[model samples]
Target: MSLVARAKSLANRDALTRVGLALTAAWLLLVLLFWLLGPTGTTEPSGLGRLVRVMGLVLPLALIWVGVSLGRSIEILRAEAADLRQQLGRPLGQDSHGRDAARAPMPAPTARPAAPPHGQAPAPAAAAPSAVAARPRPGDQRQTAMRFEPGQAQAPIDVTTLIRALNFPDGPDDHEAIDALRQALRDPDLSRVLRSAQDVVTLLAGHDVYMDMLPPNPAPAAVWRRFAEGQRGSGVAALGGIHDREALETVAQMMRQDEIFRDTAHHFLRHFDGLLARLVPELDELQIAVLADSRSSRAFMLLGRVAGSFG
Candidate 1:
């Protein structure tokens, strides 16, 4: 069950308990008033006398029932809260995931060092064409400049560097990274690498890797087309059961490191962009609609916004 649903159920149970307690308290109050007034020494039985007698007999039993039910409800809520904490790896009240925490500002790229003064005869430019035909057209030169010879030096693909590059300037590109990671996770060829990773289990657990995080609302045909173009394995279907946020986050982290997912990463990145584009506006509209309603609407609106944003 979702955390919100569990919380709501607990709240309802507590409310029932409270109603029972309130009724008991009111009955006791009436009994106290009757005792002080002595049922107004009159002829027959008065309303106060009947009220006192009934309350004196029934209120204690009702209070006991309320106490027992309240205790049970508190226990259930406590257990649920503990489970939530364990799943999130921290206390619930501490903002364990800190989704609203402001992202650290990105530092600007440092400028390259200036070249030495020209008078010293600039050091020979690193590796250049030995000869340019005097009659060569500008277009020919441009083409030559862009050509890659077979023996030319090339940089190695440093995975760490690449992962870092994938990071956005201001914060982690969670949406983009998730898309790329999903593509990677779905690649059959990367299975061995993923299985071998030291953090694979935690990653999977955290992201609820086995759960389906797919948005439930109908998506544009273009979105499906984009997803289809890069899909590679049946593994994606395994995500249907996941309902935990931490598990989903862990899965995303794993995707970032899995080599199998690299080939289709770009497709996932694009899909992430598409998802954000679609969700943000819908959330804003829903928020506005919710704010126009009652105070209770705030809770529903917040939930809607969270679901929309995450999806």
Candidate 2:
């Protein structure tokens, strides 16, 4: 069945269940009252009284049966609702699914021309350009005909304007600032800058620039190295100074000391550091020393502070 129909059916079933529960509760209450108020002695024990007595003796049993039956019915309805949900591929809750379905895909409207004013003459269609007539047929090999539709010429992008808009260096290491930079770089007008930003972000992401701006866990270093290679091809300088061991060791040590770097260092160590070390062999020994020193220093400092406070 269609989703709407299934939904309506579920609603109807739920309503019926509520009504059934209310009626059952009322019936049970009435039976209990009748049992509490014994039959009047003045009137002959009416057939209704006899019936009530019999029911009073057996009503509890009947109620238990009713409860069991209702429980089973509820379970069945729940299972049915679940099945309907799976079939509809949506959760069973409020009108959320209905609202989502309504919003999912809009219907294509039929085109209707507007009526002209009472006395106005209809506008004439413009003549096709001479270029259209001079164009070779589709099968011709030499034709360089280009189709230019209305409003096809958009404004050209200005790279200098885009660069000015970037306004970088506002807290250079800020994640939000970097994201904005990346976004600005993506503009088609600044394709070159975008490529540069991509390289920079990739390289920076590999490094521990700031604590919160750490790269993805188990960093994709190989992918990053490949990206770096591509960027260097574009003549963008690779980050960091020399590729020598001492330079790398100093850089690593600086990164370890930077408070922000520690926050994301573990992720780098776990994922990308090994791959990066292999590619830039100078970093291998430096990374190990920096990591060990950073951890021990932090541990000792924390211990000393705690001991001083206690003393």
- For residues 90-188, what per-residue lDDT tens digits would candidate 2 score against the true structure? 211113233211111112223223211111112422321110111111211110111111222345423222222222222223344344344444444
Query: Which stretch of 10 consecutive residues in model 1 shows the poorest summed lDDT?
Result: 139-148
The list of candidate 1 runs beyond 4 A from truth reads 1-47, 90-311
lDDT against the true structure, per candidate, is: 0.33, 0.33
Q: Model 1 residue 162 lDDT?
A: 19
Q: C-alpha displacement of 35 in model 1, angstroms?
A: 16
lDDT tens digits, residues 26-98, model 1?
7778778877887566677789988987887786867678676877677676655554444434211112242
Task: After superposing candidate 2 on the true structure, give the runs of residues whose Cα lies further than 4 Å from its correct spot.
Answer: 1-61, 64-311
> Residue 123 CA error for candidate 2 (Å)?
54
The root-mean-square deviation over C-alpha atoms between each candidate and the true structure, in angstroms, is: 22.2, 25.7
Which candidate wins on TM-score?
1
